[model samples]
Target: MPWIRSHITALLATLLVATYAAATEPPLSLRAVTAENNEPFNIVFNGKLQGLGVDVANEAARRSGFSLQTEALPWARALETARQKPDVLLFTVARTPEREDWFHWIGPIAKREVWLWRLRTRKDVMATSLDQAKQYRVGTSHNDAATEYLLAQGFEQGLNLDITMHDRAIGYKLLASRVDLVPMNPLSIGAFARESGIPLEDLEPQMLLISSGGYYLALNRLSKAETVAKLNAALVEMKADGSLQRLLEKWQPKGSKARSPSSPP
Candidate 1:
């Protein structure tokens, strides 16, 4: 009977220790999602992740005292995974009413502009007006915000093209007079042009269509609310102390043209 009593006490002590350890330890892991093909934002380089989204996520994790692990997946797949995983986060997401209920958003950590580019040789299409642009066909990437926004604005004459190879083809298409305009994100276009040795003078944004759109870090609704709140507080602190802006500027492409003050209406 004494041996039985000693065993019971030992088991109770073990359980108590386990409970205390669980209560005191921070979450062991955090998952983040990013597009497999997004460059200058989120991309894999020589078996490691690099880009603005990666930088922002790393900083957020450091500030929040958590370990972050990333998985490169298709944009849709990444978003879906984040939606289903309780401890997952998604980076560089654009907040929209359509997505408001899908996840808990933590920031507008970065901003980007949507612009229309055309070959300098085509001065007619280069004229500063969306109405004038309507006279010719435009090329845009599939499943992109620029495409959706343009279509919503009644620009029906557009060619859907794959984003990965669009830059290589855009200049040639414009030079050949096959497409009048190519709408793209400014940072991406600049990065593509530089990496491919295409001169910016050869392909420049004819008009800055949208001034700014915010990018966010999103947490799955199933994630612990306390964790999400702590992360948000860290992000706010980063912003207040200018760490966020400094990080973004560090990754911003060098000599990238600022949005032109005079943009086409």
Candidate 2:
């Protein structure tokens, strides 16, 4: 009996020591980037990065025991950075067919649709189809998924597509009648308009461009496979435990529905 009791005490002490060691370990640090002025998703407000995309990325990193440092850059630069740099993460990216293999995707964090928006006052601008839309000048962010899609459809820059470095510029261009149309998400219209000091009622949806696939946290393909797996597992856990849904609800405006379940594109 005495020998059995001594063995049990030793095992307990070993377990405690192991737990303490694990608790004292520091998290791995990671670098992440997103497009500048992507309101409600990847916003840089008051010199701080905090938005739905930021919140989701931060939570996923925390759950995976990684410390993430996020930076906001022009859309094109962010995409290029994530493409060429090893171990970098990009968030709020659409997982289009053209981009499926560009990175190791971690999530379908939020759903969104891309539409062609025009000024209500511009009664002369009308686009009922992609071809009809092509006849009019449309503004887009540089290297954005919408821009890539449009280009693939035979849209040429400096012809019908007016590309800007910042996503915020698209809204302003449309308001000023500089561009007859702009591709954007309807959900972000209010926030985007507010950023440009324009009324949401001024812009009207003309045509829907992209409605499939969702936003994801894209990790550089050159990153460690184990790290990608850990971040993905964290997102899966968040989905299963309703934390992802809660986060969505917290960020989404009232009366909006949240979709937390979906397969990766």
Who wins the TM-score comparison? 2
Who wins the lDDT comparison? 2
In model 2, how many backbone clashes occur? 0
Alpha-carbon RMSD of each model: 5.5, 4.3
Candidate 2 versus truth, CA RMSD in Å, comes to 4.3
Score candidate 2 by lDDT: 0.83
Candidate 1: tens digits of C-alpha lDDT, residues 77-194? 7878888888898987766555779888888887757778876666677536777666667776555566666676677743432232345565566567777777766667676565
TM-score of 1: 0.77
How accurate locally is residue 120 in candidate 1, as Cα lDDT from 0 to 100?
A: 63
Task: Give the Å shift of residue 152 in candidate 2.
Answer: 0.6
Clashing pairs in 1: none
TM-score of 2: 0.87
Q: Candidate 2: misplaced stretches above 4 Å?
A: 1-15, 253-265
